[model samples]
Target: MWDLLDPYSYEFFVKGVVAATLAGALCGLVGVFIVLRGMSYIGHGLSHAIFGGFAACSVVGANYYVGAGAWGLGSALAINAISRSRRIGADAAIGVVTTASFALGVAMISIWGSRGASFDAALFGSILGISPTDLWVLTGVTVFTVGVVVLRYRALLFTTFDPEVAGASGVKVARTDALLMLVLSLSILTTLNVIGVTLVAATLVIPAVVARMLTNSFAHMLVLSTAIGATCGFVGMNLSYHLDVPSGTTIVLTGAAVFLLVLAGTGGRRLSRTARSAPAPVRPEETVSLP
Candidate 1:
């Protein structure tokens, strides 16, 4: 295995591994909140919205990262505002913004294809082509995301578990929710750059789902999810290299498989425990009543 993964033989593989590790760590950390709040869709929505920004950047020959990041941030803020208003529910608001943003992005791409810049790579990621500047941006995003999650840990947890009680206790549930949105935005942007606009949602949800099955504690789930994501990245990259497959598709599939395995194992264990703990049925004639 060591010989097969010798970094000296292939430097690009090493870069891919590092990028995956950081991206996975960020996803796992922020994804815990996503799972708790049942807002995984928000991550998916933000990623789709980024395509508009990327299209705009390509049209003007501007920096793609700047365009994507700015547009993703704008979408996040819009979702937050719409959710706060009584006019629409959270999921509904997300649906509206994400759908419109994605459609607009597609339109922008069509209009700007007349100029230069390829859309396929941005739509699906270019891991092997990640530049040094992109690596630096990825590193910064990871750090900022992890730091925000850590700092707001208690408030976020309180809000997630018992929003009404936490709010009464001065937890500021709305602020925490928005803060999570911000962290998720950062995670989405980084993952999009690493994996591409189309599949970044997997990084935000798959590992977290797998970890939930393997562990009950939030902290443990986060750690396990990060490990699962990192493993998938490295393994998938090698498989793609050997088989001449797309790395992003392989990695996403690897994540899906891991989630299924974890789910099966967890379900099996619970079923066994349920069977053991079940009480025997009483005879029809036998009746008991408490005084």
Candidate 2:
């Protein structure tokens, strides 16, 4: 028990736990919308796209969050813009813009050769190294995201389910999309340190997907997903401390495990329901002749 509780005594571990919790909650909340909107790929794309700004900030000795947030917002808007074109599909736009941005980041890194920063940490994360400032930023972003979702709940729902109907009903579909994208960009920035650029998308996607599998109501899904994400963060951090593994990977794997469990449970229930509803076969002797 003492050994298990020992890691919590350290300030860094505490900070990492707080950071992971906040990041997980924010990702889970925003991810509900992402899954509903069929924009899961955008999360992965934006995570990569922000790497260019991260690399640039490293080269110039600027605040990483500010630089990355700005870059991510820009990429989000660019994706939105490209998706507006009749010639381009939304997924195609996301792929094109984010891939280009990721390539730019890679090129910058290759040219700069780390500049005393660890690319491995940036890509895979180092939760124990989370700074106080980063934690505050995560808090702010989480609060802002929740506020936006609460304030614009109806509008967001309308836009997500039926943009044409939402527009007809006086909802600003385009503006709502932009606002959602902004929130998504911020959410990605918040998770960059906790889950890193590569695995952040998993945090955004897995919990929401698991929640979706378990619930049909959107509000219930949001609550369940957020709870699942927070649980994963707390448990994964503890597991990481005990096992001496990467915190981010542990967190993501924990979520993955939950998803698998839910999948299996739900599938079993569905099969059971099907078996009960199936028609009984008639015996040859029981068959009747038609007149």
Candidate 3:
């Protein structure tokens, strides 16, 4: 027990733990909406799309988050705009725009290779390298996300689940959607330093999926997903330290393991319920033929 707790005495480990937990909670919270809206692909797409901004920022010597946020928000709005055409599906729009953005980022990196800029930190993350500034940014973003969700709970919920009905009920579905996208973009930006762009989507998705499998209640799902995400962060950080592996990969794998466990547990329960509710086979007398 002392051995396990010993890591907490180190400042870097402590920062990593705090950063991971906050990132997990934020991702879990916003992820509920992403999963519920059938927009899981957007999480992956937007993360990749931000790489273009990251590369551009590196070339220009600007703040990485600002560039990435601008790119992410722009890509998200573009996806929304393309998806609104009705001729294209949301997933298709996301795929088209995000892939192009990612390709552009790659090209920029290739062109700027002589500048000595490295994207490894953005691509794979360095959780132990988290700074005080990063923590402050994470805290602010997390608070903003939670506040928006709490204040506009009903409006966001109605719009997400039933856009037509919500619009008819005077819910301003378009504005709500834009706001959600903005929040999602910010959320993705926050996780870039903790999990990197490659694994950030997994952080945004897996915990929410696990919670969804365990409950039908939306409110309960949010709480459960947040808890599961925080747990994964805490446990995965420790595991990475002990195992000398990548923190981002370990955290994502932790969430995946939890998802599988919850899936199997829920599946077993469903099967049991089916078996219990099934009607017994009828005898010949009970199965009279129709006239």
lDDT of 2 by residue, 225-279 (tens): 8998899888887787788877789899999899888878888553232112112
> Tens-digit lDDT track for model 3 on 1-291?
998999888998899889989889899989988877767788899999988888888777778777778888998888767666787677777788898888888888888752323577577766665888888999999999999998888787776666777788787888988999999999888777778889989998888878766766668878888898889988888887888777788889999898778768778553232112112222212321111
Point out the worst 10-residue segment of candidate 3 by lDDT.
282-291
201 Cα displacement, candidate 3 (Å):
1.1
Q: What order do you get sorting by TM-score, best first?
A: 2, 3, 1
Model 1 weakest lDDT span, ten residues long: 282-291
Error of 1 at 157 (Å): 1.1
Residue 6 CA error for candidate 1 (Å)?
6.8
Candidate 1 local Cα displacement, residue 113, angstroms? 2.4
Mind giving the per-residue lDDT tens digits that candidate 1 earns over 63-156? 7767677787788888767766786688887887798888887887676562434566556655565666667887998888767767776776
RMSD of 1: 8.8
Candidate 1 global CA lDDT score: 0.69
Candidate 1: residue 61 lDDT (0-100):
78
